[model samples]
Target: MISTQKSFEKKEQGSLYLVPTPIGNLDDMTFRAIQILKEVDYIASEDTRNTQKLLNHFDISTSQLSYHEHNTNERTPQLIEKMLNGQSVAQVSDAGMPSISDPGVELVKAAIESGITVVPLPGPNAALTALIASGLTPQPFYFYGFLPRKKKDLVASLVDLNKREETLVFYESPHRIKQVVEQMVIVFGAERQIVLAREVTKRFEEFVRGTAPDVLEWLENEQIRGEFVLIVEGNSDIEEEAPQSWESLSLKDHVEELMENQDLPSKKAIKEVAQLRGLQKREVYAAYHEINE
Candidate 1:
């Protein structure tokens, strides 16, 4: 059994409480989070206005300080100093847990370096919330905060992650979700399963789950709205191999496919196909010889 009184008494001075607020629904706020915010000397919030709304709803009158990304470097030291003076401060984001896709990591590091105790009060998180309802494998998963914006960068990122066996989770805005989905189809394949969770816990809460291409098509027919959490299934090692296309007929046919389908030069296409299919240059040459003969 845990001893609540002992734990409270042993609480070190200059402690930092990493409190988690609701991602969308107010009811998701844990009781411990509220108590910590109320008892702490000050609250550090990502957005004061948004945090203020939550405070007002809970009737919490605790004073708050801004600790967003832009101000974290300048303000972290000062916040640490306050903790050193025996003040217990709670760090919170506009929504969800501080530092997990929010801006409390720097402060936590500072507090730890200064010998301050840091405690996390878990409550709600959009990533985990979306993952559970995604219908994808939940045990092994990877959280990628957000997708890169540049088309090339985004494609490169997805290509590297294509080998991972864990489900991929990412935060995305409505504006770019469709584009990201389209790129995902190119890198991960159209048949890959995907889940899109939009406006979670809000009135317009929605979950769209299907193959990458299908989901992309669905998004096109609806108005884009709210923040989105995307969960994509990873590569499977046990799936049956796809039937080889005409491109797989021989090294010659492979080169032809690249020319016809991918618009690559014959020489470059032959080299690319050989590398992709793991065939020796001599073997590819023999197949090409047979085609010509």
Candidate 2:
């Protein structure tokens, strides 16, 4: 590994700062974030009008240039050029961290490739804010910002992610929450636990925790509004399930499916498993037959 110690030295070029804004309640805004916004030469805002209200509240006079999804291709290079000219810039999304389910990641990636210093200021985030209070295992959580919207892609994503053991977090919209939860019930099974945090940090903020079926039932019953952050409980028995991934099937399940469907014998299935996963025959045999004895 090529390692380089970054001495706390000053760079002659301007730095790109990723400043996090409040998710909902404005009181969650940090002092340092406000100071950085004030100090920066220009602000790259996801929405200039939305950010203007924030700046007005904090008494910051930094000029904003729109940098959103529709205009990112044209605007990213311009922002990079501004920073390259030794002008410090702060990028802020509509809410929460700039790149979490928002724009600015492309700009951040471009800035880093150009060796520009990228500074991230800590502040409010909807996912973590929901996860910590979700009453689920907090450590080793997987933050998947948003899921694929299409039916096939969404199924494929859930199939791949269902086998993970870490707590899973996802940002979802209000309109699709019901259908998403319903799909989750189908893909992840009904017994899997989940924490549904809605309108987080807002006046109508609410968290509903239960199994997949339970939450699905709740969504069916309630009047859904605002955005959502889904904290899903991962597979409880991960070690056994992790060694091999054959379309979300266990090594043994894959072997069994092959045997049942393709009319292969136990030995043939085990050999196929070895060939496919690069596992020793004996190891496959052990996992398949539960040969712990």
**RMSD per prediction, one decimal?**
8.9, 7.5
TM-score of 2: 0.80
**lDDT of model 2 at position 107:** 95
lDDT of 2 by residue, 140-172 (tens): 999998889898898899988988999999999
Model 1 residue runs over 4 Å out of place are 1-12, 238-293
Per TM-score, the best of the predicted structures is 2
lDDT computed for candidate 1? 0.86
Go through the candidates in order and give each one's C-alpha lDDT: 0.86, 0.90
In candidate 1, where is summed lDDT lowest over 10 consecutive residues?
1-10
Model 1: per-residue Cα lDDT at residue 129: 93
Clashes of each: 0, 0
List the candidate 2 regions with Cα displacement exceeding 4 Å. Answer: 1-8, 238-293
